[model samples]
Target: MTSPSTHHTTITSDPTVPLVRIVREFDAPAEKVFRAHTDPELVTRWLGPRGLEMRVEHYDCRTGGSYRYVQAENGEEYWFHGSFHEVRPSERIVQTFTFEGYPDAVALETLLLEDLGDGRTRLTTTSLVDSFEGRDAFVVSGMEVGVNEGYERLDELLAG
Candidate 1:
């Protein structure tokens, strides 16, 4: 069995659910990267996974505010919503996430922005799911494509 620590994103058993992590870096400042996530207009531009378009239905990014968006893929819309738990400008954010298709499955995601001098930033997202099944579902949901592409779009956005 491969040790959990060896995985880039670990899948922990119940006892270790707290340590699962996912990290992604961006070639922009922490403030810009944080804005891409919290600004509805910017999110609508690049938040969807590959081949999909994201439509922001409602968004109020302040702490305790709620957000909703629909991702259209193959002519089908997948809805997602979450409420903000914490929001600290350019530093960190915590939110609760739930997908309409799997309403009961919820996850808490924390995003940490670390400034890497010279206009670069490191964004690490740690999502804690309610159960192992929830984590598996999230991993299998093709989120990687969307995430990577979104960052690419952000790069373009920053440059232009």
Candidate 2:
């Protein structure tokens, strides 16, 4: 039998500040979970909702490196790019994320991995945008569905 989803994703935002925080747990080790995030091939498999197809333009997971990718659905392509500011393998990643649709608005994102023992891991992510309005837009953009479903796919990847 498949195990229940131990994963959880939460989004918190306020009217006064532009930030979103997500916390999720995985039934795998921190190393495995972190690798899935940094590895371009693994990321393409689980970075979005199930129906979207992903194509990586370039991905470099080391410090000072950058990445760009596109997700296509029904012939519509969504572009995203980011620069890695800091990369500590299996522990933390700090990067700037931008969706090409909103060219001028970029968010600095930090992802931290914690080992929960027994081969479990917890991931905490914080995204800081330029304005509360931008942050609210993200929260209303059906982000939960993408985040939750993407993690579910990641779960399958880990299991395999």
* Clash counts for the predictions, in order: 1, 0
Question: What lDDT does candidate 1 reach at residue 37?
Answer: 87
Best candidate per TM-score, number?
2
Q: Tell me the tens digit of each residue's lDDT in model 2 across 30-74.
A: 999999999999999999888999999999999999999999999
lDDT of 1 by residue, 40-92 (tens): 98878767545788888899988989998898878899999999999999999
Q: Compute each candidate's TM-score over C-alphas.
A: 0.85, 0.95
The weakest ten consecutive residues by lDDT in model 1 span 1-10
The CA lDDT of each predicted structure is: 0.76, 0.91
RMSD, each candidate, Å? 6.4, 1.6
Any runs in candidate 1 off by more than 4 Å, and if so which? 1-15, 18-20
Q: In candidate 2, list every pair of residues with a backbone clash.
A: none
Q: After superposition, how far is residue 157 of candidate 2 from its true place, in Å?
A: 0.7
True-structure lDDT of candidate 2: 0.91
